[model samples]
Every structure is written in C-alpha cells, then in structure tokens.
Target: MKPTETDSTAVDWRGDSASSPDVTRRERLKETYEARVRTPALVAWADWRTRFGLLIIGGYVLMALVAVLGLWREPSTSQAPRLLGPFTDMSYPLGTTQSGVDLMALVIHSTPTILILITAGAVWATLIAVIIGTVAGYKGGSVDRGLMSFSDLVMAIPGLPLVIILAVTLNPENPVVLGVIINISYWAGLGRSLRSQVLTIRENNYVEASRTMGISTPRIILKDIIPNLMPYITVNFVFAARYVMFASVGLYFLGVLPYSTQNWGVTLNFAYSNGALFSWQAAHWLLAPMIAIMGLSLGLILLGQGLDRVFNPRVRTRMAGESKSTVADDDDDTVTEVF
Candidate 1:
C-alpha cells in the first residue's frame, strides 16, 4: 500500500492525475450539452424574418380559388346592375360598366385568365433561362458566343413597342396565344443572368469531381446544376409573373389587346371612358381594380422575400435567431474542437 501510494503521488507530480477524470468527463458532457441540445433548441424557437411568405402564399391561393369558382358560373348580364349581394340596387357590388356588366363578376371571371398568363409566362421564361444558361456557361467557345450573341440581339428590341407592333400585326383575339408572344420578349436577359451564375457554379470543386467521375453532360446539368439554381429560378418566376401582368395590362390599356375581354386593364379603360375617375359616386369603380393589382403585386414581393430568407443559408441562420446574443452564441459554437 505504501508503494502504491508513492506511485500514485509520482503520477500526480508528473501532471497525469486520474482524480480529475470525473471533472474532464463533466466538462465533456457540458460541451456535448451545449452542442447537441442548447443550440438547436434556441434556433428552433427563434424568430423567422421570412414570416411574410405564409401570408403571400395564402393570398395567391385565395385568388386561385376564387378564380376557379368563377370558372363554373355563366357570365352574368348587367342589364340592371345589382350591388354585390342579393339586395343591392342596379349599381354593382363592385360597381357597373357603362354597358351594365357587373364589375365583381368581371373581376372574378378575369382572374383565371390573368393567372394563366402570369403562370405560363413565368414558367416558360424560367425554362428558357435555365436551359440557355446551362448550355452557354458549361460549354464555352463557339456555342457560348453564338447563344450570347443571339440573346443580345433579342434584348436590343424594345419590349413595349415590339409587343404593340406584334399585337397590331397579328391581331390575336385569344388570350393564351397573346400570352405566348409576350414571353418571347422576356427570356433573353433572364437567360444571360442565369448563364453568368452557371459559369460561376460550374468552376467549383464539386462540379469538377463530378466531371472527373465521368458524369454525363446532361446528368451534370439536370441533376447537379439545375437543383442548385432553384432559389434564383423561383425568385425570377415571381418577378416574371409581375412583369407579364404589367405588360398585359399596358397592352390592354393601349387597345392593342382584344377590347371585348373582361380583363382588369379593359375594365380600367372602360372606367376611364365612363368618367368613373371624375365622378365621385363612381370612384369605387376605378379604385377597386387598382387595389387588386397592388395587392397581388405586394403578395408576390413578400413571397419572394420569404423564399430569399429560406434559400440563403446565411439568411436562414439570421432568421433562426431571435436575439443578438443567441445568434452570437450559435456562431461561436458552430465549430467542434476534437481532442
């Protein structure tokens, strides 16, 4: 026992104490506690800066539902304009056109058409961007030069004047047909921007590894490049929708589109023709369409903002933290030290 005690003292003197094992383990446990438990819990409960996304998505959903409902109903004649509900007078609930068409019915009926135009244009434009961007960026040389030059040529043509010229020349009566034409003017710039991004992403080591592993060019583009480009594409879709809507309205306002259609722009034109803006009693007619446009635009803007917060990891981290100290704590503890 005396020898054993002397050996233990020697070990301790050499700074190899065993009595501190429990303390070291406890320290390890504390570190584990902070890493595995506290950090995640704090992040889970923290405030999200992109809370507005839900609201934006909700608004779009509501508009879609309303449009769907309107699809089933027959167009109502406004011989005697009834206010919005069952009891109101000849004045429409929303108001009436000079021809006595109910504004509410017009708005409801036209919603789907507008949604179709917006959705189709957005999707088509985004597709053009992704395809052209990937091809031009991944394969430089003659291909890049030819595609980019073509893109620049398309961009140089002014959208409004060109759209007006096309509309006047084609005289398209169908909304869907006209919408397709509008998409042609939008994809060039979007394609160029996307191509620039693809050029940057393609040079990364991961893409190089995929190439070294002999991944097919199609596989690399579709499986690898496209997925990573989703956030940008999603945002671009929303912006494109807004742009298409504005273009559609502008064309309609200028009488370049079919005048008989119950589009929002047509309604605005009719309201102006009927002096709705100048007449105090008819001001609501002009105001309602303006409000609807603003609401839709705002909802899209908010949704895009929410998506930005979600897709950007840095923004996501910031969104995940409620307070400054909690954020700092997270940043400080992000790296694990192995011993």
Candidate 2:
C-alpha cells in the first residue's frame, strides 16, 4: 500500500500543472466546443478582422431571431408610407422600399434563411464526405477505383451550370433544396480530400495497432480514423459553406427560382431591377442585402481562419502554451516559439 501510494503521488507530481481557470485545458475545450464545435468564433481578440467578422455575423443572427419572434414589426405595404430614407421615420427605421416593405425587417428576416442554407449545406457535404471517403479510402482496391471514378465524373461537370440545370428542372421553393443541390455538386471534392487524409491516417502506427488487435474495420474507422480527420473535415466544411452562400446568391440573382423577401438574393435582385440604385432615396434597400451577404461571408471566412489555428495542435499550443522561445532561423515565428 505504501509503494502504491508513493507511485500515485509521483505520477501526480509529474503531471501537476499550475493553471488558472481561464487558461486551463478544460476552459479552453469548453470555449472551443462553444465556438468551433457549436458555431464559430475567432483566433484572438487582438485580431480586429476576425473579431468584427464574428460580431457582424452574431449581430445579424440576433436581429433575425427578433424578426422571427415578431418583435420587429414590419411596416405593411397596405397601411404604411413607402420610400422613407433611414432615420427619417421611427416607424420604419432604415426606411421602406418602393413597395413599402420595411427594409430593416426584410434584411433581418432573411438572416435565418441564409444561415439555414449554409448550415444545411455544410452538414450534407460533410456527411457525404465521411461516408464515401472513409469507405473508399479504407477499403481500397476496386472500391477506391469505383468511388474515385464516380467522383471524377461528378467533378467533370461544370458545377454552376449543373446547379442551374437542376434548379430549372426541379423548381424548388424550400431553401433546404438549394443546400441539397450544392451538396450534390460539392461533396465529391470534399470526399476526395477526406479520402486522402483517411488513407494517410490508416497507415499510422496507432491505426495499424488497432487493426492487428482484432478490432473491426468499422470500429477502427469510427473510433480511431475519423477522429483524426475531424479537424480537417471541419475546416473543409466551412469552405463548403462559403461556396454554398455565394453560389446560392448568384443563382437567386439570376431569377432561377421564385423570389422571396426571405432571400437576400431575391431582395438584391428586386432592389437593383426596380431602380433602387438610381433612386438615391431608396438606395439603402439595395445596399442592405449586399451588406448582409458580405457580413456572412466575411464571418465564415475569418471563422475558418480562426478554426485553422484551433484545429492545428501546433497552432493551439503556440497560442495557449508559453513554455518556449524562438530560434533565430525559424521560418514560422509562432511555430518556433514552442520548445
């Protein structure tokens, strides 16, 4: 009992760390899960671009929620006056359109629609990537050849053209279908990326050990292989979302589908087509959707940048750990600071 206690005490002494609540691994993990795993934040408060990126996105999302709850009363076309410039009227702050639709409410209301499209698109793309990539990469030979051939075929088609063709054919109303169409076009690239990563991971010593220990292939994939690729997968998912956002906007701008005030693309198209740009009185109507889209894009892009740091263990270490100093000749200063 004495020897056992001594051994335990030695282990604890060796591993014990002086940690504050804010800097502890547990706190960091919680923040990571909340920001990266849940939605997204940024790398550092010092980085103004990333900070504003998250702030802009979060602010719009809050506004959208307010709109959804009916707390933001949109001035109806039938009762309210039209073309009121921003701050001129308290009833419709930010003004109303030529048709008397409250510009603030229209932009705010469209927030959920945009977020839903990107999120649904990301999930669909990631799911397809995991399933096909894991199976194809892990179970190679004929399976790999078949899957790669299919991926190649899909990649060969012009993505925007294919999406336009499909949109024209199906005539979808639900915004979810736009996300699905993007998945069909974009998942192949993600699957290919994931497949390569899985192949590299499958050859690792830990994975090999699992394979030799009578562990099933599915278990090895789910418990061992996939976990290693999640960071890579997450980064790619953000990229996929970026693609979906811009593509959907372009599609809607072209009038490929029915217009909804809930869609920023439609809002932009309506504003531009109806001479809002020429009418300086109602120019905010044109710029509102543009601002909304830019904010969303910038947030996702910067969040992805921040996530690149988080997902990288070395980057995470350099950011959170302060134990090392740089070598004079190191190419990456941040990387070199870790001893």
Candidate 3:
C-alpha cells in the first residue's frame, strides 16, 4: 500500500525501529571500537582459563594489600608462633622462622614489595620497547641500525652475569634501582619484537591511509599502530614482569643482594643458609616462600596466554566458535515472582 504524505514526510530516523535506519559513520566507528577494543576483554573474561588466572592474580593482589596495610594480624603476632610447625596450633599457622617470625605473615607481607618491583620493571621495559620499536620500525634506516646496534651490544653481553654485577654494586635497598636494572637487562629482546610488529602494522590499510592523508609519523603510530599492538604489549608485559620477578628473586636467594629486608627471596636465602632443610620438620619455612614464587610465576604465564585471545586476531578467530557474548538479550526471558 502507498504511504500517506504525512507518514512519508515524518521519517523514523531511530535505528532500532521496524524501518531500520541507515547506519551512520559514528555508529560504525563505535561498533568498530567495541569489536576491536571491548569485545576481546569480554571474550577473555568469559574464558575459564582467563577467569582462573585472574582469580589467582586477584588473590595475590588482595593479600598483598592486606599485608602492606598491616591488617594481616600484627607484626608482633608473627613472633609468637616462632619455631612451631604448621598445624601445630590455630594461632600459629604455617610455623615460624628461627628468628620467631610468623611464616604466613612474612610471606604475605613480603608479597606487595615484590609485586611492586616486578610491575614497575615491566612498565619501564614496555615503554622502552614501544618507543624504540615504533621509531625504528616506522622510520627505518640509520635510526634502525643505530638502535639495533645498541641492543645488540647489550644483548651480546652475558645477561645474568651483568645483572648480578649491577645488583651487587648498586644499592639493594632501592627497589627502583633494581627495577631499572631489570628493564635494562630485558628491554632489548622485546624492543626487537615490537619493531617487527610495527613493521607489519606499517602496511595496514588504515596506517597507509593516514600516511596518504598527510598525518605525521608520530601521531599515526600513536593513534593507530599502538592501539593495534595492545594485545602483544599486554602479553609481553606479563612475561616481562614474571621474568624480572624470577631474576630478582634468584639474585636475592643467592645472597647476591643484601638481606636486610623481609622478602620471600631473602627468607629463602636465610632458610637455606640456616639449615632449614636439615630436619624434615623445618620444611615449611623454605616451602612457604618457594610456593609463593611458583604461584606468582604460574599465574602470570597463564594470564599472558589467556590475554592472547583478546589481542591476537588469529587466536580470536580460532576461538570464535567457543566465545559467546556476555551481554544478555533485552527480551530473552521471563522472571518469576510470588506474592
């Protein structure tokens, strides 16, 4: 049937109506952003592995916060259960160190400091990687050669030996210094990887279009390239945090760094040096810190692998069949109520 002039004149512009309106540029951009940015996070959260990994990570964070705030019982309370074995008493859970330090309290309290160190180191390293990789990859030529030469020089040197020397010579009390040294030690490899990623991003249609439209290199890289590489960045950042953690803990455990602080690594060092392993009864002291370190490392690795789905398009595509939207339909079901 032919519509009346009044009905035809009053166009229903709203998108959700029976006569669906044409999609606007703004709507397209919004959908694109959601698909590229928000959907992956939703997808990752929906995955069991990702959810479990996040739970582990969140547990540590909560424990660390409690410890740092001194709300995890009293520091003096840790001394009361001194020399007692695990499950010996409800008050003295997890036993105590020879120095009368409460085992659980010590481990919990030390968690925050180590987390801060590794997180800081990872951020520093990621920043270096992005800057160097983007510039080298995008600019290409003498800049690439010079930057690659610098990285090569550092990479050629024995990493462990260099880290040990630096740690021993520097102030061990300052976590910032330790974090910086870790960044210096590991940024080269990630920088190279970032450069390779940028090289690929350079050929992307949006990037080329921006270039053709007279956009500056730096702006284009920042606005377009970096956003695309978020998944790679997130994955690498997780790995880098885990790497520095292991390195720092190993250094502390080996007695290469000062043992004045109450840290898991320091506790392990003292436990080993003081013969905590001589008797089967004294196992909890060493085992406690060891377990914490292993848990942290495993959690980070799992988180990284899970995060791969959010950033890597290939992985996302492969998992597409399995991942369903978390959002519920507006009119999908009925609710039951009784008076």
Candidate 4:
C-alpha cells in the first residue's frame, strides 16, 4: 500500500540525518531561536571593554543604592569640621565642604539624580528618534518629506542656546523634566540620521519580502527593521545620555536650573562659588565631582563601543564561531580522556 500525501509516517522523523529536510528546518529554527533569545547586554559582556564599563557603572549604582538605603552619612548633614582637607580625617575620606557636609556623601547621593537624568533623557530622545525616523523612512512620499523637513528645522536651531532658554523659561525642578528639557534639540539630529539608515534598511530583500507577503506596515517595521537597527539605536542612546549628562551639569553649574535637588553639578557650583578652585585646601571639593563625571562618561562611551559587537550580525557570528570552536576543542579533550 502506497502512503498518501498527508500520511504522518511518510514525513522523515530523523532530524539528525544530514540529508533530511527536517534537519535543515530544525537547524534554521534553532538558529532563529538562539538569535532572538540572546540579549545584547549578555552578548556585550564577552568584550573586555563592556566588562570594564559595567564595573564603573555598577560601582556608581552601588553607591546610589547605599545612599538610598541610608547606609552612609547624609549629604546635607554636617559630618566633620568645615573645609577639612581629604586624608586629614579617616572618617571623612573625601573631606568636608565649607558647610561641613561630607564630600563623599555628596558625590554618592548625587549618583541617583544624575543617573535618572541621563536615563530619562536618553529614553525620551531615542524613543522619539526611532519612531519618527522609522515612520518617515518607511512611509516615504509626503510623510517622509514632512517629517524630514520638521527634523531639519529643529536641527537648524542652536542646541545649547535653546536648552538654556528652555531651562530659564521652564524652571524645571524635577530631574526627569529637566532631562527632557535639556534634550529638546537632541532628537532632531539623531532622527535625521536614523531616517537615512531606515531608508537603506527598508530596501533590503527581507523587508521587501515582508511587504510582498502583505504583512502590516507596523509589523514589518517592528519585526524586520528595528532588529537590524539595534546597533545604531544602542549607540545613539549612549550618545544621547552623555549629552544629557554634560548639558544638565553645565546648566546646573551655570545656575540656570533650579537648585531643588542634590546634584554633581550643584556640588561643583557650590565648590567653585566658595573658592575651591583657587584654594589648595578646598580643591578636593571641586575635583571629586569632576572625577565622578569623567568616570561615568568614560564608562558610557566604552559601553557604547563594545555594544556594537552585540547587535552587529557579522561581529556576533564571528564571536559565536570562536566560542563554538573552543567548546569543540574542549569536548575533544574530554572524549580523549574518557577513551
């Protein structure tokens, strides 16, 4: 008796057979699953630069957590003699400001605000850029022209001056609101760049295939386009965060932003206002915040660089190949020992 076309037994069950179509299909599915399941953060950890960046960022987070839990001296409370130089007292490691507040506590407490500022700003900018850019590029025609034109208009405005004006006008006290205000001019440039990238991405065969298959535009953009654009998006997010950090700090240092909260910038402002820059005894006050800013910025920049490998298919494939080869070698050694 001949097997029918729908016969269950007619289908090959041997997925291990090299020549079997089931094997090919299974392998493809496995690859797809692995690709989707692997997160960029975990993939980025293989790079030494990412590890170092994480260490720096993690230290700041730990400090912030410690402050939040009240594990250390309050940043506002006087803990030692005013203007006591660092190393003068074992208890006050980073010394005390002119107000007798512990400099180390100030730095630690400032972490949460700075982190929140950067995070909020980056998220806002990146979200706007991705949405606008993706839509403008994918839609084309009048939609593209309109979006691009608006973006160009925004790009024409001077970023810093506009931010300063907004800061003065809004008088935002909330760090999140302050972050959004500072990044007002940031999304336009990034959006334009992302639109250009999207133009190229939308022309790819897979995207075209999706379009031909009558897939919804939103689905195509979400599934096909965004995944491919992850590397650019990740890098831009870091860039946006860095810009927010610097801009917010500058605004605070200049006293344009309301001093409603503890901040690294506010610390710097107070330090310089109190003559920390000119006096040797007060130098620690100025230098501590400066070092913190630089360290945090360095970590973000390094993490961005390392993250390129996490999302770039070619780089990720190469890394995976190397890992597999190493595993294969170890397996051979283990098998030989057993034999």
Return the TM-score for candidate 1, rounded to 2 decimals: 0.71
Candidate 3 residue-wise lDDT, 1-339, digit = tens: 897877665554332553343456668887787677666776687677788888889989998899878787754465474578887876767788887878888888888878888988998999998898888988889999899888778778888888778777875667766877866758888888889888898998998999999999889989989978888898889988988898888888887866555788888887888888886767888998999999988888878878877777766665553433323332233222221
Candidate 1 yields a Cα-based lDDT of 0.72
TM-score of each prediction: 0.71, 0.75, 0.80, 0.85
Model 4 alpha-carbon drift over 4 Å, by segment: 1-33, 36-43, 326-339
Give the poorly placed runs of model 1, Cα more than 4 Å off.
1-76, 79-92, 314-339
lDDT of 4: 0.87
> Each model's RMSD to truth, in Å?
11.1, 8.4, 6.1, 5.4
Candidate 2: where is the Cα deviation over 4 Å?
Answer: 1-54, 75-81, 259-262, 315-339
Candidate 3: what lDDT? 0.80
Comparison by TM-score, 1 against 3, better one: 3
- Please list all clashing residue pairs in model 1, or write none if there are none: 81-90, 83-93, 84-93
**Whole-model Cα lDDT per candidate?**
0.72, 0.76, 0.80, 0.87
Error of 2 at 177 (Å): 2.2
lDDT of 2 by residue, 286-305 (tens): 88778878878888877666
Q: Quote the lDDT for 220 in model 4.
A: 95
Is candidate 2 or 3 superior in TM-score? 3
Supply the global lDDT for candidate 2.
0.76
Residue 129, candidate 2: Cα error in Å is 1.6
Best by lDDT: 4
RMSD of 2: 8.4
